[model samples]
Target: MSYLKFDKDLMINLEYSLYRNILRTNRKGAYQNTSISGCNTSKYQGLLVMPVPFLDDDNHLILSSIDETVIQHGAQFNLGIHKYNDDNYSPKGHKYIREYNIDSVPKTIYRVGGVILSKEIMFSSKENRLMIRYKLMDAHSPTTMRFKPCMAFRNISQLTRQNDQVDRSYREVENGISTSMYYGYPEFFMQFNKRVDFMYQPYWNQGVEYIQDMQNGDTFKEDLYVPGYFEMPIAKGEEVIFSAGDILVNTSALTDEFNAELKKRTPRSSFYNCLKNSAHQFYYIPKTDEMYLLAGYPWFKVRARDQFVSLPGCTLSVGRPDDFTKIMDSAIPHIQDFLNDKPRKNIIKQIDDPDVLLWVTWALQQYWKENKPVFKEKYVDFLFSIIDFILSNKHPNLTVDPENGLVSTYGRDVAVSWMNAVQNGKPVTPRSGYLVEFNALWHNALKFAEEVAAATNKEVLATTYEEKALKAQQSFIETFLNDAGYLYDYVDGTYADRNVRPNMIFAVSMDYSPLDRRQKKLVIDFVTKELLTPVGIRSLSPKGYNYRPRYAGTSEEKEYAYFNGCAFPWLIGAYIEAYLKVFSMSGLSLADRVMIELEDQMQNDCIGTLSEFYDSSPPFYAHGGYSFAMSVSETLRAKRLIRSFG
Candidate 1:
């Protein structure tokens, strides 16, 4: 039996299948994303999407979608669905879907008149390629499969229209044709494993709309270029593979290559396996084989803070320490460039986020705990340099307080920390000056650096970090602890914003904290009552200011509500850590209860992955990135922690 499958009753219902989408990544920044019923519902949906680094850092949708038609007795049935204006779907091909399953990769079975067809989708891990294998399961007569590809050679974040700039020509490749709609992009190829016929009919299919983007007040209509169709015959029980990618392929090897890549996939049989599969998708290497972890799917790029925060769980917790070394091997240099005031490098644009260096410190701490030999060999000196740079007040945005030893940043003008949602050129939640998590991370980094230095026999450095850590501990208690028992979210001069945000939970969750055991317990209790939800940790409590619980409104309104009330699944790991630290064996029941509730979310919104943010109130509608890197990473880490308790 499959772990996640929707039957014909569910698949034929457009209401059910349209809201749920599936994403498949090539592990190299390219992806194939669309709804489960083979309909493109968002601007980000595509079959062959790749990053053209020469043009920009964003991904371009080379192939928006492929429309397949099953033909028998010269009668054609289009097994494809596309949304247009006024909630109308042309051809309404979803009615033919028999079942949809992702037990391995995505396999959708469609039944036409007397014809049962199955299509399996897979991605090439090392290359920018997507493959779809179609098998005529049970056919009453000779069947011909027709493929009509919709091309959108534009950035996935933007919409394309009927324009004259498109190159409306094609050249024959191995068993298919190669064409590019725009200049400065690679020639996208469509090939088949067997002999096929290509018909040349170029036209723009306009007014194709995306429902999600439309509701979000974004430009949802696009015109896709259709370069004719392909015709191929198949016998009953015969399988053929269709390959699409930026790179040209040998047509004869399509079937074998698809099977070979399919063998590399880790089956989504269990919760851990599904998360493990999702974790592998965030590894994006766009240029020069330089590895980086993309923050999330469809939209987010490689970010310094997210790279570090998500690296340990996505790679280390999933037991891929070598990938951890590989990605950090490329990232450490870029991070150093930012710290040294050098020009920006190729990827990882957000190195200047206020807490990026602090996150790197924590990430290395995780590495050291996992594998000391590699950590020392690759990152020990680098760690020492990062701590030394921060201690010396060299970072552009961060400075260490000489009196208190806590880290501080100026964020009244521009938001500097991870709560970086902005509206109208101003920060929605400008958490500046002695941020709670920033200081928590500072204290933890000092303690961790002291341990590393002392173990490495650096007595002077160890003593320096230890003394500063002590000063920071005392000042943290005096400055952030409020009359309500929980720590203030941030403090600026005489102003202390005691918003019951999740930032305070990190102080209790970290390995080294200034708060004593009693204070930590108090924090956990307060947070559990005020902020904790089944989905994850609420960014701010309902009793706090700007308390908008629903993640609905105009685009700007949504941005304003962001970081004010949206509950983030990425906080599950830290929340669990704080809970387990305070309650230990006794906390397992409630802790596991929260986690199990989140586990069911794997089947919601997106299959095998968690969304970026969920509504804080009941029904917890997922609202942000469909497949968030931190969400999968932290969930994997929490699951591993749960096993350790047993």
Candidate 2:
């Protein structure tokens, strides 16, 4: 685990109750001109944006450009919340108005740019009301954009209520309902005199002319009114009017000024800088409850929990016991279903897949091994639960082929694992049969289960898992090993796929009894020659038919080409581990040199920040961010692996 200079007070404040919203507005032709609206109560923050829409020559709008903008804008809104909203507060009510201003304002003192903009306005609090005014100084044509606001709430009191009602049955009363007022476009403005039902729409597909309803006493509502309007050719030195009006009835106590004062007390410490320089490559956002891997570039994004490949180096080497606990707690609940007799599908599904399961088990085992002092009875129980889950749900029908214990995964119809992809609703890579890497992962998982069971004094469970692990190892070796001594990527009798992929590295890296010295050397040589790149390791060898340089094209082309030849920086951990294993066995001087080269390579490619993947071509570019955790974690692990050599 990595050590970070985290402020306890700041961390606590981040966990406080808050809601936020932002509104960004920009013109059609001039993309540079932009305005933002920021709104929040003491409990929440909200955001919305009006972006420059890219148009074609014929005056017809390009759907692709619109889609891209929406995705990018939406992603930015999500990132802002993930980055800033320390306190999670859910928004209540149906009518929401967010405004932005670019011109100078009386109360506006701080400005990120020349634009003194009011970021957001929310209609959640009964006593507190937020209002933002904006004046666009210059733009080609006025353009307006709407945003779907996401709200998070503090449920401390609700938890107490839930606990109290756990044993007793009581009637819950719902009160304090607020209704949203609807207005028709630039021509007509229609305000709803009475509450009406509002239809919830997807974030991306939100357009004008949508109806919504108000819910009584609920902190969250699906459909909320956040509308925008922009008139083009406003001419130079002109302004646009934007503001939100709040209507509060039957509430005597009003505290808008007090709430504003409360918001002002929020700490503005630059924690991002600390995170950037920290030994750990990634940081977890407590409010959005997601992890971010600094993938060098600003644009790359990824899911948090998929960093199993980077965990050892990211958390363990940095000595972040707290992070380790968070990782375990966060992931265990989602993965618990897989541990039971009836396998529970995770949010992403495919939790039963060996690779994911093995990765989780590996992380837990390493955590226990490194932080034994912090290993309490609860930790042991958690580990045992995972072990029991894996043991009980052994797919009897889903056996490895007698010829090769490889598992199969395939196309759209059958969901094999998290890496599952379908093109046009058809499975892109079918592996419904035995796949080599799956078995390799399974073998390692069983070994880890056995180790955990033994360590926790579950002797009978340990013995059973050990027997299963042994059988798996035997089956894997017999089926996957080729005449050349290197493991085959996959095999189905005569139809054998002898690809030099990185999946085989896990077999030697995680297994208790890895490949023999000669076999290890051979595997390393093959991988280095075929899959290794200056930035990292390629998913497939360049010599293969599927190989394509890592460059953006159409969506289908990009996806197909990416895995075929794209260099995944995360795989460096496995490669480094495998190299160390080989060096330990052979007493090679090249091991130290390789370690130095690897570190230099990572730093050079990522510019001090590890990335998800690098281009498998000249002047390789890094892509994605969330996966950076793996790269950072692995680099840290590689340092430890080198230290072990010393």
Candidate 3:
């Protein structure tokens, strides 16, 4: 039985199906994302989006979509759906959908009049290839399935327009055709099993509107170049396969190749196990044996902050400590190189965030604690290197206040935190200075470094770090605690941001917190009353002046609301950590109870995956990127924490 299923009632409901999405990815950094009913609702929605290293590092949508039409008795029934101008969906193929189910993969059943067909989609685990298999479950007679290939050879960040430069011609390959819409782009091939006839009917599909893109203030409408259709005869009980990839392959082996990848995965049972699978999908191995974690799906790149923050949960909690260690080893060199550079004029001046280095320190601490004596001495040396780099204050935005020994970030153009949402190239929430979580992380990372140094008999280095940490802790206590007892969200030399935010929770959640027991309680109480929600923890407390209750509307509006008040499920991980730290078992139980909603949520947006964020108000609509890597990773981490507490 499938773990996640949507019947005709939900599939045919345009509103529901349009909101629901499906994602399939290969570790090679290729992915397929779209609405559950096979409609392209977002610019990121595509059948084939992969990194074209020759052109650029960014993912490009090579094959925007491939629509199917079953020709029976000269009557054409399109099995694809699309949103054109004015929100009009042509062919409205969702109406024919009988059921949509997801177990190990996505399977959709379509019933058109007297004919019954089922489609299954999967990706190659070792290659950037996607395969779709269709079986004629029950048919009255012989029918022909025509697949209309839509090509939009453009970066996923941009939209395509009707232009004269499009290479409309396609070269015939084995059982398919290879085509490139423009020069300097990878040639995408669409192949099918059995004999097929390709009709060169090249034209422009204009006015294709993506509602999500429109809302995000991006180009909503685009024109795709259709290279024509491949018509293949089908018989009852026959299975037809289609493959989309960089190069054409033997069509006969696609099914076997796909099945082999499927069986290679460890079997999953519960929702958390399903999430582990989703976490695994975020791993990108660009080279022979070097793997890194992609931040999120559809748009995010491999970021150091995301890779570290999500590593413990994505790997360690899933009983793959070796993977976690390898990822850490891979990321250390990058961090070291960034820190070796001279100071930046501002935090925003450096694209590789300083917070990423802090998170790396924290991630190493966690992994080391769990698997003591398992890591090599070189890993410990790497930790010391990070410490020396931090102490040097080589990052322009980061400097230690000698009087207090506390780290401060001076920047105007960036928030310097995860709440980074820029609209007009400026932070929505300009968080400069000594952010509460920043200091908390700083203290924790230093404490960790001191321990590693001391344990390795480097007393001088250890003593230096511990003394600095002590002064920072005292300064944090004296400077951050407001009259309300909650830690100040951000404190500059002149001003302190009194906004009650989830950032303060990190202070208590960290392995070492400067806050006393009473202070920790106060911060937790304020957040629980104002920021905690069933969906996730709110970025800003509702009582705050900057609060945005819901995240929706135009691109500007969404950007403004990005951190002001959107609820981020990923934060629940830290909140749960703080809860356990302050309240012990009761805190963990409360977190487990709150997380109950996530099980049902998995059936929504991205099946078997968690969304990046949600609206802060009622209904709490899931927003931002779907199948976000950190969200899935952190959710799995929280689950493991809860289990351990029990």
Candidate 4:
């Protein structure tokens, strides 16, 4: 009945279920990620991954996993699955799973002979906590439930091994206990809504293997500490809730708190709604006054370019304009510090990336198209300043060519652009010159700022901006456009790199393009032929020299595939926009087909959300980050554009 339901056949098949994972976030950096079979297949897969700001910038796996054991008449069935050495599974409990779905929260139903129990997991919306509600749906006899938590108090990226360094100590708190494995880390608290008996039998779960990490050429084995287990009795139709977090809570009010959090969640009932739900998870609000857009889950962080690129769709298109403003306003100080050549004192990384500041203006452009008055009132000055700063050659890596007004990268690193995958300290895709997309964005930013300045009665500034835009527009067409009608990827002075990449699509997609209608149509057609995949737009054409057909194999192979030919869903926004721009209503068929093909993605990869990138070819298996902000945001934007055809 649920949209994302997995039945007994699929649940029992480890090959099908173990690779597919589910993710839940608190929007304050804490999250729950694990395989559908309740197996911890990745080091990043945890029951309670919390952000310990005092310790470091990365999210820590405080509660690696919690195994649930259902006991009846002196017999116990552990409804938990863990991979060990030689690919062996311990307490292989996935076979007991009758169904697994995420209609509201992720719920896994298990039937063990005479007892049928359901486990529902949810992360608190505002706190660093993971709550799992266990209900004995139907029981022939009295059932006792035992919870054994696997603790690994280490950064999510790192694997832990058994060491005497762990304190291995605990203290009572509320209806449960709390303990910290390390000195600098916060103590983890585990409690239940009802009174339970705690059995302090410490054990080590040695060499637990992560299949995904093993495939990706990482340290796939780890030792998880099992401090003890909690035993409690359950009756028919009775529900008991378990909580694991960084702080103690009022056990009595946990039921109400769980319900409260549930009400705030958007049900993943349909494709758009599932995206809306996943999109909301990327929001990181450390405090009520401060906010940031996390780039992706299980890894990544508050990246500057990602924040701006993800802002409008994740916030504005989702009808959270208030949140849009909240995030944009929070970025003001960082923008100021970057432009002024001051110390970069912010959590948002890559502020020095040449294209990061330009993307900020593009985000403004997207918002401006929807709400003009608010754009003028709230963001005009910010746009004007940033554009002026770029034009002045004050950006650390960017400068305007005095002769043509086209902004060029001066001393920028090769990996600074979005094709940022590096191997052996060198870029796989060295785009270190006048990038076509950067100039397209530069020209768009110039024109948008000029329009705002003119409207605001800043006549002198408007004239200056317009003059520069006109020069850039003329030079862009002359320098980037080739005899084949498509644009070059980048121009290193006299040498124009004629690689058929997705970067040229921006020329047709942007609000203000230097290309004429015919030129735009040609570029769009070229992109449709070379870069367009069934899933999205590929980073490079399949015919390119280093083009990779898939996003699979070892870590090194994936790094080679990262920007070589991997299709990025984020570029779908621009491709769809360009298609609609050139073909108008006539483009609806392809647009609908693209969206339909993408709809199937929700069932694969990470379940309800889009992955960071897909294989450039058929049966496009998702790769890179599990839940990417740009992927969700831009796909939402494309959907909004398609709906506008009505």
Location of the lowest summed lDDT over 10 successive residues in candidate 4? 407-416
- Candidate 2, superposed: residue stretches over 4 Å from native: 1-305, 338-354, 394-421, 492-494, 585-608, 625-627
Give per-candidate clash totals. Answer: 0, 66, 1, 0
Between the candidate structures 2 and 3, which one is better when assessed by lDDT? Answer: 3
Cα lDDT computed for each candidate against the true fold: 0.88, 0.43, 0.83, 0.89
lDDT of 1: 0.88
Q: Per-residue lDDT of 544-643 in model 3, one digit per residue for the tens?
A: 8878978777768888888988888888888888888889887866887878977778888877788889988888888877888788887888888888
lDDT-based ranking, best first?
4, 1, 3, 2
- Clash count for candidate 3 is 1
RMSD of each: 1.3, 15.9, 2.5, 1.3
Flag clash pairs in model 4.
Answer: none
Error of 3 at 93 (Å): 1.4
Candidate 2: lDDT of 378? 48
